[model samples]
Target: MPLKQPIGQKRLTNVAIVKYKKKGNWFETACYKNKVVDWRNGTETDLDEVLQTTAVFKNVSKGVLAKEKDLVDAFGTNDERAICTEILTRGDLQVSEKERKLEYENLFKGVATVLSEKCVDPNTNRPYTITMIERALKDVHFNVDPKKSAKVQAFGEALPLLQERFSIQRANMRLRLKLAAACKDEIQSRLAEHKVIVESKEADGATVAIVCQADPGLYQVLLALVRDLGKGHGHLEVVSLAVQREGMSGEGQASGDIQGILKEQQRASELSQVPYVTSQPASTTGRLRARSEEDSMAEVSYPRGPISGIPDDVTRKPMFLEIDGLQPGWEVELTKRGESGVVDAVFFSPSGEKVGAFVQARRAALSASKKAAAAQSTVE
Candidate 1:
């Protein structure tokens, strides 16, 4: 006896079905057993063989044939159901293929654009070119997913691997930083966490000047830190750069060349812009102050406390008086002067608020004498 095939057993193959409208009634056209339906030409060859193998027709014997009502109920719209049926059954095959190809190409381009924008060449700090990105994609042999958008495919599958294969190198750079006195401690603490080398530090009054060497990537991190801690009052300038290294092996020669290049770059930068001269005070009030254009050019000075036992001249003159509670190094402008003299010591708060000022008695007297001489000369 021959082996029995299972009951209700059916051969399985991918089927293509098209729903279409005939007059006013909904109908479905199908290709079965891998039959090649010429969708573009609206032609079907081997109709007998296709009908014999079609799954839908096989189910017709079981009273499972779908009617126009079923199509309407499933799609909820005659137009939509008809269009779907037409696409499945007799839509232009060449046009559909072209659309699919266009979508795939568009996705590829989108992925390339994203990679270019998001990832940068580490050495140049610039984005990779489209060609370079394409080459990278090729190297990775990335597969494009028809169901997903190009950006999704690039980010999800290609970006990480491409970055790994075409990595960028970190550059060495020198930075001149002007930190607010209030945030000095915090900035210093954060800098200590990185491999930064402090070349010099100058504290005049409320402003501190810091010259340091670090990787270029760390500059962004420091900027964020400054903006947060200094409340937008901190400033930084790149003084020099040691771009992506060349293959020079001798330690001494490489060091000498690097130093020479840095000097040249620094000189060029200085010639292009005004140099920043920092003056930090001995103590700070922990408040950030804005620096005006005029203030940048102003000369910064500190007050000298009265010498011990050299009692202030009560009879000769009482010059400038010191204001308590004002942080040192605050910028001061002389606004008023005694009739005979010029103001001596002026003080300000970190936020540019004036504290107080005074003048010396001797200087007042000298100023009075000069006025007297000028008046006498005018009379003569």
Candidate 2:
């Protein structure tokens, strides 16, 4: 039997054919170095013919081989078809063909420097020397295929467009990651806050809803009111509260007194300085004295221990304290000493006695600072 061809040689045999499987997968059979693979499945008889063809010429057909030899005679081995194929596979595949010829002159001009320094000549298989490489680079044009042809072009061109697309994708991914991380951190930190667990009947199941006791809408409205009061009122604050069972009993007294005090103070402060009365009422209607001076004949309904002397407005609405920026946790010390100092802080609590430690500390600090500043300014 004839010597079996090597695996590589068999892969490129003249009869190299591909047959699609029933599932439509391509199957490789035989091949040759020069002849193209038969995309249409050639039979055993066709394979025999291909083998005969291969026997006549080892690599390429006789005509091609003769042409290669003739070109080499005039322009040297640089013009060899084998060399051209090698150049195509290598970096020279990017070379522009418009400025130069297709044979030795073009190939050498395109890749001589690169072959000298970065690559080796296929035929010689020798490494490129630095001096020869430098000489080639100086004379050679960059062998890059420009994306826009005298033929057709698209909205986005080649590599640069691809790079821009990749960059935008990367940025969006990073932004999403950052947002996710921030949300996770917030959920972990605020988890300790006491929330009312509300149950909702849904189509699938009962959903547990966590509700914050502090009303965000009320807080926002209060903040806006304070802002309108100017920078001098930056320390002013308000809190939302709900009345307890016992607290509702004193609503009438609290509402009357609180509204009265606020209106009197506001009127006095405005008149003593620069009073510009507008059509808008200072406080809600039917709350404060209907007629400002009409209440002069009214008897003072003062409570004995002063605790019963709560304002009517205070009684109607829930009791809330106004304080400076308090973080969390503070004590409420209601004493003669507290009265002497500016009531700069307000304490929040479910019970009357125990106050938030954070609010107390904050109020104490702010009051001390304001007093000290006033004292210093007086002395100066």
Instruction: Specify the highest-lDDT model's number.
Output: 1
lDDT of 2 by residue, 1-380 (tens): 89997654332323332121212221122233222212122222243333323221112311222233433443356333333232222211212244324433433333433232222211111222334332323323223333222112111222123222111000000000011222333322332342211121112222112222222223453344334433333222222132111111111222333233234334433422423222222221221232232233333232212222334443211222233222222223321111111111123332334343332434554675588788889999
Candidate 2 whole-model C-alpha lDDT, 0 to 1: 0.27
Q: Relative to the unseen true structure, what is the Cα RMSD of model 1?
A: 28.8
What RMSD, rounded to one decimal, does every model reach?
28.8, 35.9
**Candidates' lDDT values, in order?**
0.46, 0.27
Query: lDDT at 187 for candidate 1?
Result: 72
Those runs of model 1 whose alpha carbons end farther than 4 Å from true positions after fitting are 1-95, 146-155, 168-180, 191-380
